[model samples]
Target: MRTMMTRRQLLQSIGSGFGMMSFAGLEAASDPLAARQPHFPARAKHVIYLFLNGGPSQVDTFDPKPALTRFHGTSAPSGNLKTERKTGALLKSPFAFRRHGQSGLEFSEIFPKLGACADDLCVIRSMYTERPNHEPSLFMFNCGHVLPGHPSMGSWLTYGLGTFNRNLPGYVVLCPGVPVIGPQLWTSAYLPAIHQGTYLPNNESEPEKLIQHLRNRNLSAEEQRRQLDLLASLNRLHLEREGGDAQLEGRIQSMEVAYRMQSEAMDALDVSREPAAVRARYGDGDFARGCLIARRLVERGVRMVQVYYGNGQPWDNHDDIQIHRRLAATSDAPMAALLQDLKASGLLKETIVLIGGEFGRTPSVEVSGLVRVQNGRDHNNHGFSILMAGGGVKGGLAYGSTDEFGFKAVEKRTHPHDVHATILHLMGMDHTKLTYRHAGRDFRLTDVAGTVVRDIIA
Candidate 1:
């Protein structure tokens, strides 16, 4: 009878396909967050995800459907597509779409500021997801699954490449308040706890107030260092006794990060240090501040930074679709400025700026009775739009298309898995090869499926 080989032994013996997965095993013994070599030449070193939580209406945003406008209040074609709630006759966009940039890319008037940077954007209009609900869609988009208990894209990136900055976390999530699934959206899950995203409540502009308990009032720096050293030593001894504990190791690493942050993090989070003209350009609002902070974090070598629009589903406009105008007013300038700022700083070539929501709103008017108003659209998982800029993505382009009625992705259909795969590709990691052994099986960010939308890459 053949003897059973250890997982590591098996992986080493058959090494042709494993590629970076084998390298990852060798690096696991070192500091978990230390920077490591990518599987290949990396186009982007950092990622900034502008998560417009809640389903935003794609027809009103990047995907302009003249058919919906022409057939306004008409019901003959396409019939009713089943979604989370009941919907009525097609509801044309209230806002007008105009061509912008040298490429003549179209954008809604609600985002006039973003329209200025239209040439930098690659809008994907044929994106789809499994569920229409906020919770599952958010989970699918952020964590690559419709269920909880999976490592987020940020977590996966950190696990694959570690981080450039050791003073701060490899992955940082800036949200004024908790979104739908809260920290679970950034959870490390089967990955090491240390790879989980560091949550920062970006409600305050002041660096000190932005991160509470950042500095210890009672202990001096030297004394705190001594205490931390003692604690780390104790933890290491306990770790040796326990064989291995990810949670304990995570706590140890977090303490080291916190100690180092006493200096580096303060300077990184302080946007006021930027020139007044620069700050004014981004405009005012929590999201604007968050965007500015995201640039700052990435500039300081943070591997991934996710800037959520606001607390909860700020874009989930069920009662009235007009709420989008209000939401866009808050985000447009900052988002545009971020793209421009990255470009001006020459970071755009090496940094990715992704602006999107989990899913999108329906094209037809919602009649679900859940809301008092009839103007809003229902949840739509069939088709949506997202903007990807920089990080080697083709600029001034719209890669795919939705149906004429803007009801579904009819051409070059893209999924969240595809987006994740493409992102990992840009960062010099193969989505299929970057695997982590978990629960007696190898797991990946793309789960069991994904195809890198290579056509979208520059």
Candidate 2:
């Protein structure tokens, strides 16, 4: 029997005597999602980012500004900081704030469930970003860039450490609907596509609908396995001839993951499998369900899971800041339950949990064309708040502060890049060294500037 070889393969068999070595390298590259070691001992093995989708009001959530209450209906002491829209006098948070837990961490009435777990939270009240618009801010938070082409933090982590479970993706995104910035927020961009986040529109609880084409409808399990074996053989041949094209390699890897997922993903995503008490603890809603799935995925050794609060910037309350109360009601219980469950299961020690939005709302009231909007607040990029828990962070502490009016980050200021750096550091990666060379320059998650806020570290 004679074996036919393509021109590239023929040359590879005879060229430079390094074909075997090159082929070995190609074989390693073929499984880019294979688990790899981190730069050092990792503090956190997994990360769960509970992105609030839109800008949540800092004063109304974690950072309670007593000054706002004192000066209600009066012009802000610092005057109106330029925001996305016109604003009026200071608007106090309607929900009363009370100190909770042994830490005495103040929380608004909207997050009663979270308040019970306040001691476990390290609230950063001085978070700021460069933009106020939804697109740029979302990009900044997710990708560390104001532009759209950078890989997200999840992608960077996946590329750095890969995944523990080959059956599941390294990075998964759960959103009931597309966010304001769409898929760009989770895109891998210049990185291999395999590192990009696998988005699951979790509006539906059924695993089959949540993940389209998850099962082989026509072929039986064994038949599909045989077909996949044949397909992989062909793909490997094409990959060898093409000298390991990244896209082709990624596709091949994706197909294998999809195949393996058919066996386990359904069970992982099925919230009904949990005890009724457990399900009830997390509450009943899409966001709550996503939190549960995040826990399950991380428990199964998935590297990163991001649960976007909702589609189309639900937290962007430019009209009625009261809407934040409603949004918080929907998310607070699940958010708290996630932490409690992780702690109870011992996953909290190794899992990083982050809760925040793109930015925050202005301290002053926003005045639009009508009087009805006077209760709303405009977008404020100067300052905000975010909560971090477990994953080697110092709990029962508030690390930073906004001004008296909650208008600006006055002390221990932090940026999105800093957050990225801190997260990578927790994952045992040096943000400065975790670079991917593209366009003739080595790009990192922190970009040009970011200092890991050591104060927040445990």
Candidate 2: Cα lDDT at 261: 91
The 10-residue segment of model 2 with minimum total lDDT is 1-10
Please provide, for model 1 over 321-375, each residue's C-alpha lDDT reduced to its tens digit, 9 standing for 90 to 100. Answer: 9999999999999999999999999999999889999999899999887999999
Alpha carbon deviation, residue 322, candidate 2 (Å):
1.2
Q: What would the per-residue lDDT of candidate 2 be over residues 184-258, giving only the tens digit for each residue?
A: 989988887788899998788988888988988899988887787677667766766667566776776678778
List ranges where model 2 is wrong by over 4 Å: 1-30, 240-244, 370-372
- Please give the lDDT score for candidate 1: 0.88
lDDT of 2 at 244: 51
Clashes per candidate (backbone, < 3 Å): 0, 0
The global C-alpha lDDT for each of the candidates, from Candidate 1 onward, is 0.88, 0.87
